[model samples]
Target: MPDSHSLRIVHCFRAPVGGIFRHVRDLIDAQVAAGHKVGIICDASSGGDFEESMLGEMRGKLELGLERIAMQRQIGPGDAVAAIRTYKIIKKSRPDVLHGHGAKGGTYARLFGSLLRASGSRVARFYSPHGGSLHFDLATLQGRFIFCVERLMERMTDRIIFVSKFEQGVYARKVGEPRCGHALIYNGLANREFEPVTPGPDAADFLFIGEMRALKGPDIFIDALTRGSAMSGRALTAVMVGDGIDRNHLIEQAQAGQMSGNIRFLMPMKAREAFRLAKVVVIPSRAEALPYIVLEALAAGRPVIASQIGGIPEILGEASPALVKPEAESLSGGMVTAINDLEGFQQLLPGTQVLRQKFSVENMAMRLEAEYFAALGR
Candidate 1:
């Protein structure tokens, strides 16, 4: 394994936005502190100047290197061209371990890692699904095709790292039990993230910070906001912070509900910065593989009302009051209750000591570092 602290690690992923990017950045920071050299290879086509500045900060911390290549989001002939370019970049980096963060990243990591082995290079290949392609169901043609690709990719991978047990279970049910090594590791919060955040004097009543996609249930949030306001008999303001393809649709939904004046849409920023603008964090996701918002909000001592799906229950607890069904009516009811009883809802949040015991970046990095060495047959 070339010693844990001295291993050369390379991470490949499609975009430098959202949770996957955050996960990789935290990992690289910890790896560097532990004396490991790490590099990143991700899509340059997606992020804007803000994301680029974040990546620029990443470059200062990474000891191995960084490569930003033009990559597409969906499958096409262009993927072959992108893979060849990514392979050349990875090969030149001479990494001891190649870790793929999402679907496209996993595909490139395994195929190219295997190809390198064929040419006498030694490198450990690991994939973390992060609810990418596995969200599709086998009842559909695309789902079956992706599942098949996953099954084939297993042969080349040394180990598959599932960020949540819910994700691991879903992959097993959809793609079948893994033929190679696998582990269930929960996503962790940084030490700084654990410090409580005090909302500004002009803080809103609620905050929604994530992609504007329907999968994240922003529509449900908008609908519930209107419904909650009606039920409470007063106007409640909220902020939606993020950008995605679904932004216009969500905006229309908010406007159609006649709550647009009460809702504010801001571009994405650091979660901590977003926290300062709202007293409570709302995670209305229809599905997740242990979202960082849940941990981050809880760590910052904010109450959360999240849908009871995926690894959310695992975080908020099966019987947690914050857990609600992923529907507008249910969400509305939850919202009304939260507004009517803010103090009670605040009391229901998971304790800081409990969160610290369950999700910490130190634990996550230490376990992953050991797993990387183990995958090398050390």
Candidate 2:
């Protein structure tokens, strides 16, 4: 039998990529270190070789074990089958806390956790939106249906964890204020990540890393590279890193814009490794829930030029010169400014001392552990 001191914690999420995956890994590392049994349930179809290597590394550490199932990105007829399989795997684990990250995971954790409760299991259900379904326009039919589902799921959730104040406000506006307990806990970096990464001698002028989707602004980054080069009266160079559904489209975009000669596209690698390949980092995302890229770049001592969307302002400060509107023109202008005075722009970022104090993985883990016990009435 599980005791209050050490609980069986299972984390469910759809994709094993990007910030959500990184967030779960951090939590699992910390929880395992703190003497709790931890497990993971994520999509089998979502990640590539890099993600597979990460999962393999984590498999040995998971006490409740890692279970991967085929999970689709969109709502489909297969959801019923996926949910049933997920519930069976979760039941076999007998988790004390069922914590879900993103939309599909949140749905599964809360819905199945409630079912487990009906069967006399004392499981606490927790959900973190991580800017999943909230990215959809509230005016769209799809958005309305998703929000309605989110509203209904609130009653089943024991706690809702928001990674940013921006995410929290968006939820309140779109899905109605959460009736269940909630907390705003920023995503954090490990101590080793805080060590500065020096750019290589052959590094490019800028870097664009993340998914290749339009929402992530890869096309915008390519356009900005072209425009910024024009603004500077010289060709600019950049490295675009990551794999996604739109990767080929983005490559075509770069080619059509005549930026193929100046841009280098690479598969997803460690953030710090990519950081070293460029002098400055660009996060042109249209929507996010506290991206780990921004935190990782800053911790690695790389200058970041990011969009003013999502919780970026909260991380980079509203007044920072690096903040730009999520548009080709705006981002290009920011890039040009950085090119003109890179050192000056770098100095404008938040101090390392401040970032370490607020965004340490140690602090993030401790606070989350406390919240877990609080929900359990321990």
Please give the clash total of every predicted structure, in order. 0, 0
* Global lDDT of each candidate: 0.89, 0.93
lDDT of 1 by residue, 1-378 (tens): 346449889999998888888888889988888888899999978866768889988888776678888888889888888889999989998889999989999999999999999999999999998888888888999999999999999999999999888899999899999999999888888877888888999998899999889889899889888988888899988999998889998898888889999999998899989999977788898878888888888999888899998888888889998888999899888877887788889898789899889899999999998899899877
lDDT of 1 at 95: 87
> Per-prediction TM-score, please?
0.97, 0.98
- After superposing candidate 2, which stretches have Cα over 4 Å from the reference? 1-4
Q: What's the lDDT for residue 258 in model 1?
A: 93
Among residues 3 or more apart in sequence or in different chains, the pairs in candidate 1 whose N, CA or C atoms overlap within 3 Å are none
Alpha carbon lDDT of residue 318, candidate 2?
A: 87
